[model samples]
Target: MIDIRLGGARPESAQGCVAVPVPAADGGAPVAITPGLLPDDVAAEAAAYLAETEHKGAAGSVQSLPRPLRQPSKLLLVGVGAGDEAGWRTAGAALARAAVREAELTVLAPAELTDAALRGLAEGLWLASYRFAMIEPKADAAPKLAQVTVAVAATPEREAALAAARTVSDLTRFARDLTNTPSQLKTPAWFVEQVLARTGARVTATVRDQDQLAAEGFGGILAVGGGSAQPPRLLQLSWAPEGATRHVVLVGKGITFDTGGIDIKPTEAMQLMRKDMGAAATVCATILAAAELDLPVRVTVLAPLAENMVSGSSWRSGDVVTHYGGLTSEVHSTDAEGRVVLADAMAYAVARLEPDLLLDLATLTGASRVALGKKTAAVFSDNEELVAGIGTAAAQAGELVWRLPLADEYVKDVAAEIADLNNAAGNPGAITAALYLREFAGPLRDRWLHVDMSAPSWSGGTDGELVKGATGWGVRTLVRWLQGLAA
Candidate 1:
């Protein structure tokens, strides 16, 4: 991890490059930076290098003073791109990648940086520096980047921005750690133990054991985890302070490791199945951030935790699983177990809490991944207000999301032969899956949105704040949305 701190003055000597923020090019060569940002000889060479190179100061563009190296002794100017929050974050990720082999960097503050922009930069640095090293490498192996110091005037705003970024980004890393853990260690019961230990007193985490689940009739959760030695669990983490009104409930599908149950996936497909619980990881981080930030809005997270493994006891494709509140779903494909368990949590949230707003998140469909690719989240709902609000918040949080239709036309495709709903809907799979979850929404259907984040939930590479696995994709957006509700 990189230690990000505020500094008053520039250091005379540094192990790595000193990066200064430069805005995007308006016209001719990118906006020029002062020679004060670099050594005279190196600055002169960089000037000549810039004239020969195509460094336009666009976001993620970096111009090393003398020459670019895997680990730079100096990189003079990094593009801040209009100096917005996203720009700062992009710059931080770019710089971190460029200087990974070096010791530290001292960055000069932009001329006028907002609190939001500062937070973005700090978060980018912290998140990009994250490495999930469960195993210790050789002593001579590449060392982690140590520190980042931003040369800026200290103020309450600066302190608040840095503190907020640390809280959110650290929790995001926490979620990443959870997602990156091997499936052998992250069983449903073990996941519940993590929730209890991690959340502690900051957020009230309650767990309903297997017996409680059976008593409460969470047939979907039980059936999904039946093959595993570790049983299913219903975990609720709440952040309710005094006098808070608007109640928001989020249900996350927490399938620890999905081997696709009786309808098992292809051999190569199960390799990344350990990340199937990404929705639960993200939701846990989001609510924890809310509690830490002391957001004055009542919010609760309902995670139906299970592991869909293959065994004699595994749920079959033709089986009917009754969810919480007695909503029966016919399992057309055991691979579609995510929505089956997610329905139970959403129904429980509605029947018990009666929240003012609801949203369910899961790595549900491959069709969504095909439609939106791996970097963007796909959302579906009939609730116009809910969609709009989430759009605004996602944009502000620098998380990309595309709204897919939640048209009722797909409802017919998901109607079951004998049960209340069918778990699998053929093509245009993303929309049909959303319609299926909406079956249990009841009154909340019109006020809810279902996020099929199959693609963004786990990343193939470490780009930006996201690491290579378990992106913790929705934490920032949900926290930002909750911040808006409090405001």
Candidate 2:
């Protein structure tokens, strides 16, 4: 993790590269800088550079100049086009990427940056600076922006906001590590131990093995895990703080590796299947974040772990699996195993926990990816208010989520001829998948929100706060939403 702190020495006295925020001038006026932030000589030097380069102070733009002072080697003018939170965030990310070779950075914030904008700046820097190189690389190959210090007048509110931003970034990165782990080391049993290690003492951890799940009738998990040498597991982690009035139960699909069972996916498609467990990583990190932040809300997480592989024992497409609580689902496509396992977890959550909100996230459908593209996720539910609230939370958390209609008319499409429901219903797949999960929600349907994060969970390339692998998409949004309940 990068070392970050708030309210260090003044910009002129900073130890490493000094970065100064420069707002774009109105109507092409002269360059403007905070009156007291920089010394007269260095400010004059920066003004000269901006004029020479014709810099307009566009958001996420940087211009470097030699510092007149002998101590600091360089001067950076980071742009905040509109000086808004979004602009600050972009500026922060851009600065981080630009300062990769520097050992330390001292960022001079805007004179009037609000708590919200400050949080955005800190979050952008931390998230963008994250690197997940698995191999042992040469010493010179590593980028070295190890320490960051923000130079500003510190207040309790500002310091608290910084700490909060750090917490979210650190936890989100933790989730990213889990999601990016190779399936060889990330089996169902390994995942459970990882959860137990991080789940603080305030939280309780329960592990149900294949035998327990079989006795308890968790057919969906067993059916999915039947093909792999690794058995299935159901992990329930809970953080129930005192005086908590709201309870939120989150369910996630934990397919550690998906060869798509007997019905295999294409070579290219199966390559990234290790990320099939993204939702489980996200929800686990989220509930643990709630414990770390010590929010006044009760949170429970249910993760159904499995690996859908190919073997003679693999569950076939025509098979009907009897799930927990005696509900039956026809496996129309073994590739649709995410929602199958998710159904068992959601049924367990709905039956055992009385939740103010019931939410489940999964990388369940490629159709969802087709509809929403790679950066945005598709959310489904009958609760309009809950969907709106989730959108708001995603916006605040710097994650992307869009609500897709439940389409009650499509409810009939999820029905199977022989069983109660079909795992893979026909076209408009994302909608029918949500509808299928709703069948298992059973009377808690009204409060349930299902997120199909098929595309957003894995990033194809780095963009701003996103890295190239497992994106840890939902942890930020879910954490912020749960924390808001405390208010």
Per-residue C-alpha lDDT of model 1 across residues 129-240, encoded as one tens digit per residue: 7777678877666655688888777778888998888888888888888888998999887888777777768688789988999999899999898888888899999989
Tell me the deviation in Å of residue 241 in model 2: 0.4
lDDT of each candidate versus the true structure: 0.83, 0.87
Residue lDDT tens for model 2, 241-350: 99999899999889999998888999998999999999999999998889888999999999999999998889999999999888999889999999899999988888
lDDT of 1: 0.83
TM-score of candidate 1 against the unseen true structure: 0.94
Question: Residue 298 deviation, candidate 1, in Å?
Answer: 0.8
